[model samples]
Target: MTLSVSLQHAFPGVSLDVRFDAPQGVTALFGRSGSGKTTVVNAVAGLLRPDQGRITLGDRVLFDAAQRQNLAPHRRRIGYVFQDARLFPHLSVRQNLLYGRWFAPKAARRAEFDRVIEMLGIAALLDRRPGLLSGGEKSRVALGRALLSEPDLLLMDEPLAALDEARKAEILPYLERLRDTFALPILYVSHSPAEVARLATTVVMLEAGQVTIAGPAHEVLADPTGARGFGQREAGALITARVSDRQEDGLTRLDCGAGPLWLPGITAPAGAALRLQILARDVMLARTRPEGISALNILEAEIQDIVAADGDGSAVLVRLQLAPGAGDKTAPEILLARITRRSVSALSLAPGLRVFAVIKSVAVAPGAVGPQAI
Candidate 1:
């Protein structure tokens, strides 16, 4: 299923003219603050009427300004998970979840209550009230309630924004499970590059009020000009990798376009496919392979392009394409490294020049690695 939206909304000084289709799996609305991420999601959920445009899921028309049709939010069959849990304080977890199921049409009740509880790992908290649960627990309960509603499309507006690091970590795995298991399309709003890198299959980036960029997660992140949207500090490349082996000294090996990579704190089992995020700031480049390097992971690549900051900043983002891993025939993947303009000049780095990308094994935190959503 796909969600097509074309919206035109004006808010005094800021106006939005946005359009995009959210395909199956998680489609993330990624951009800086005030980028209209929430506004677009709100329009799709029928929370607010756009000045003009149409919104459709499959053949159903949820909103059409020209036709004077505006479906009620309750009738739209879209599950919304806001930044806050928003569960009924007095109700137990089971009661809150069942409350959502009450709105489902009898014939369309496909998400069973027991299955949702198990999937969200909320069975233990069924009898507990929302007030008694931890932050992560509350988020899981809120998501479970939405799933129990049997929604055709799910809308998440910065669902993890309010959680602390621990809470965010605890809930991320459950969120991944939701995306992988659910066959319906999802519209997720997040401004964090790390979160977007973790969950998004398709990414639609909004800026001011317009769609600055939109495409598959890896392609969007690898866009050389994306620094303006994702910010220079957050620019990175998302690579598809498979766990080749688990090492003896607390490290995991992954096979990717960069060949074999060793990373710390990877808990996934061997043969598991996952996504890995490499921040530009974490990558160091060398014109030639050095012998006494302490970095465990080094890949041979050719410089594809170089992007210098628009202003006086000395930092530049150098794009590189790595050779495919052994027995891997897919196209080479892109990687980005941020180095000073002086370093670029000293190294004589330019497009088509071969170089060695030294990636610090410890720089990739456990949070930077996520399950492959496709």
Candidate 2:
């Protein structure tokens, strides 16, 4: 269920044009408030008619200006979950969830209602009205409703925007589970980098109505083009890994494509796969292997690429292929590390230079899940 979209539209003063391919996993529409993220998604969902473009999911054509075809919102077979969790106030949670089945074709409604309810942990709220549920609870019910509809594509427009940090935290794991449990493609909209880091499989970056870059989550997130769209401080690398071992001293070890990563205070199972994000500022580089350091995970890597920052400081994004089994560099796993201008100049770093990357345990954030790149 791959989705491809290329669209151009006109607003009062800004023109919107973005083209990107979305994979089967959750594709994040990430940008600031007025960056046309929502506009592109709305066009895909049939809420906004793009002046020109084509949108297709596998074999279904939702929009094609060249063919003069535009499907209405209802007929699009896409379930939309807005920021407000727009559940019916008068209807019980059960009825609100069942409402989703009304639009689903008889043959297409194969998604089990009970399973979705259990997955979302909304079973207890089934008999209660939306008014009685908390913000997080209401959002879960909305998600269950969307799943019950068995949509081909799920469009979530800043679904966590309306909630506070506590409530947002409460719902994130459930969202992660949804991404893993279903085969449905999702176009998730968000301004929060944390949300993108935690949930995105593919990322389509947009600026004031223009597509900046689009690619795999880690690649795009680490690319300077994507990083510049956000502030330099927000620039970072997303790495995929799995929990290989856990220590009793509150440390977790991850087997990443680049190498093993050590993080502090994670409670995941030993075999649980995860995604790890390294903030640009948290990384330090070394020209040669240094002896005696507190850093637990140090990988010998060849610098594949580097990009200077806008002003005084430069952000050198080093692509690393981790030294493989028994300290072997021949079959190393690949990773990215962002170093500053001073370090780049001090070490005279160039592509192909060998360097040791030192990362701190607290620098990595949890809740990242993507396919391994090794």
TM-score for each candidate, following the candidate numbering: 0.97, 0.92
Candidate 1, lDDT over the whole model:
0.89
Q: Per-residue lDDT tens digits of candidate 2, residues 163-275?
A: 99889888998888888878878999998888887888889888899878888887787777787665666667776577888888878788766667888767777777666
lDDT of 2 at 254: 82
Give Cα distance to truth, residue 68, candidate 2, Å.
2.2
lDDT of 2 at 292: 90
> Among these predicted structures, which one has the highest TM-score?
1
lDDT of 2: 0.80
TM-score of 1: 0.97
- Model 1 stretches astray by more than 4 angstroms: none
Model 2 C-alpha RMSD vs. true structure (Å) is 2.6
Candidate 1 displacement at residue 156 in angstroms? 0.6
For 1-374, candidate 1 gives per-residue lDDT tens digits of: 88999999999899999989998999999887898999899999998999999999999999999999999999999999999999999899999999989878899887488888888888899899998999999999999889888999999999999999999999999989999998999899998888888898989999899998888888888886665567777788988799988878988899886688999998889889988999998999998897797898899999998887446769888888997667778888999898999999999999999999999999988898998885
Count of clashes in candidate 1: 0
